[model samples]
Target: MPEPKEIGHQIKFPNTLMGLFKKGWWEIPEIMASSCLGLLGIGLGFIAVLNYVKNDGDNREYKKVYMIMRPDDPRVPRLKNPVYTQYKG
Candidate 1:
């Protein structure tokens, strides 16, 4: 019987959106277009991530924060912060 083939690094390339957009994928026009789109996408993604991390979006308490302030609220919820609030979803 033939020996089973090795499964070494069968995946040769990244399949994610950003990963697929990496350099050397396109030939010319596609490369040109992707260059612009890819860079913008990367930049925007970075900004989004930065904004998320910067505003404590990953915090446990941040998720449970109230959307709207109640009358005579005693404390500030992370939801009170506009930038981080949108990232809840």
Candidate 2:
């Protein structure tokens, strides 16, 4: 019976940078284009996260205003006297 082949010994890895280039898998233009697109995606993602955080603060402010303005709303707690009374001159 034939001996079973070793699993990891068959996998070939380049020992040097020159050997890697000789493999025909590393094209300069394709690498540059892919890297640029990856950077652009990361930048856009960062901007989206920042915008979401900023908008979250604005949303909280709007919710506070809505609750105060519509005290009669079931969601808002009932109070004997309103928090913001008009100032009389």
- The residue pairs found clashing in candidate 1 are none
lDDT of each: 0.63, 0.61
Writing each residue's lDDT as its tens digit, candidate 1 over 1-89 gives 99998875443546777656553454356766877899999999999999998877764545655455454555444434434334455
Per-candidate TM vs. native?
0.36, 0.35
For model 2, how does the per-residue alpha-carbon lDDT over 1-89 read when each residue is reduced to its tens digit? Answer: 99988865443547898666544344466776687899999999999999987655243422334444564675334333346667699
**Strongest candidate by lDDT:** 1
Q: What residue runs in model 2 are displaced by over 4 Å at the alpha carbon?
A: 1-27, 57-89
**Residue 82 error, candidate 2, Å:** 18
**Error in Å for residue 85 of model 2:** 21
